[model samples]
Target: MADNILRIAIQKSGRLSEDSLKLIKECGIRFDNGAGKLKTNATNFPAEILFLRDDDIPGYVEDGVAHLGIVGENVSEESARDVDTVHKLGFSRCRLSIGVLREHDYQGVSDLQGKSIATTYPRLLGQYLEANGVNAAIHEISGSVEIAPSIGLADAVCDIVSSGSTLLSNGLKEVETIFRSEAVMIASKHLSDTQKTLLDQLLFRIKSVQAAKN
Candidate 1:
């Protein structure tokens, strides 16, 4: 590893990981990921890849552990870490939404009052509920939030809905969308001059690829 290498953090797995690597390849960068390595050196670029959780990417970037990161807007917002959105990757599109059992007599947002809502994104969900004047009890669950209602853990659940299959399988219906999100490129506040130059180059390539999609 070089002393001044630009480390870019990306999701180790899940929807954003594939596209993140694909975009790097399309941009003419080559990296080798043989097995379960945490960090991989790019063969054709002046950057190193750090495979990390999407939710933790923003914090890594903000703390200067990573020079840049690829993460979903939802995770970035939910993390509330100090970082800059360099580009919207236009992939892994989803919405943070409030959901309840299909049989629940959900009329509108008002029906959520005094209800227990389970969610991974408590901060964002809380903000949305507060703005809507709904006094819902938020139950913070790390994952499987959709199952909360069915298991009697909560009256409803707030979570990210992509194709809505998870909600459908769990017998939940989306009632309110708190935020629309997609994967994005994020940068830390601190960067050396050489790293900044490299970042600019990477951003240019990303922009070119993004434009080609449109």
Candidate 2:
């Protein structure tokens, strides 16, 4: 029974989670997502939803633990997981950017040469730097990347920018955009025939829902 159902992984909480659930509901899938519930089954669809950390969703999908996942492009690319990006949900859009102290007389990406940049997205930052011919040192940190420059941990920071309010509050200014990200649907490369059919149906409904918005 459960073996034949499609498993979808989503963030347990946050704006991404809210948007993901809303999209699911718009697709006519009903499910109970009560507080503290980690997993739920859709009442009228052949799907089960697994609530998890945003970062873990990619890995779960890659491992086939969850046949599909709704994750931000940032986390998906950062994880470097082996998964197929099935669709772009068009919500939760943001950019990975490099920021430096507001008063640093910043010029351009070349200004990052030989400087240390703190970020949670080292792989993306490293790649961007390599492509730009910048030789900055990447300081990978789990959190508080915005405060790195203020505290002297790094000369600049590479992190997600939404409203840029966080960077303004931290006395930093955006210098370069390394990546643009949005909510995206990712799927395991390996899927059973039944699961594939269910996924196709779900994608159709999702597209219809998105289309109705425009």
Candidate 3:
């Protein structure tokens, strides 16, 4: 049931979307990406692009609904999906860091013991805490994680930090970096021969673009 056109899922908006589309363009693939469109077919390549929330990309790829995806390593690791990382795009670099009130005493990971932490990445935070044997309670929140410490929602917060400005402005300071992340391309575990052939061509173009930039 595999079609000649391969499908790739990418972030609909936010940090990763623009770079994802730029990568496609650099690969010499042409498509109409009008706002409000969920999907579009490539005019010059045998592929289709599906615009979706970054959170949903892994699942779609894992389920083979999408043959491939572009997302941040932070999300890819957290989702723990059965997709394979095809290439690292080297964009959208950030770290998953643990932050607490600037005035709070944080000697080490041990300081987090018996504390409450707010984060969107519960699984990753949990793994880090467990590895350090710091049995802290995780308060999973979808957004405004920086406010967790100020509003007394939690003693610490774990979230993505780019320049640390968000944490600094919120009266929080990063005490530990749990994980480093960058944009990456992921493919479904199973791909038809035709799809794999097309993917190889896409990868060649992508590598050429990346090489030209570096």
TM-score of each: 0.97, 0.98, 0.98
Those runs of model 1 whose alpha carbons end farther than 4 Å from true positions after fitting are 1-3
lDDT, candidate 2, 42-108, per-residue tens: 9999889999999999999999999999999999999999999999999999999999999999878
Query: If ranked by TM-score, best first, what sequence of candidates would result?
Result: 3, 2, 1
Q: What lDDT would each prediction earn against the true structure?
A: 0.90, 0.93, 0.94
Q: For candidate 1, lDDT tens digit of each residue in 13-82?
A: 9989999989888988888887889899888778899999888899899999999999999999999999
RMSD, one per candidate, in order: 1.3, 1.1, 0.9
Model 3 misplacement above 4 A: none
Sequence-dependent TM-score of model 1 = 0.97
Q: Roughly what TM-score does model 3 have, to 2 decimal places? A: 0.98
When summed lDDT is taken over every stretch of 10 residues in candidate 3, the lowest stretch is 1-10
lDDT per residue, candidate 3, 99-140, as tens digits?
A: 999999779999999999999999999999999999999999
Q: Arrange candidates by lDDT, descending.
A: 3, 2, 1
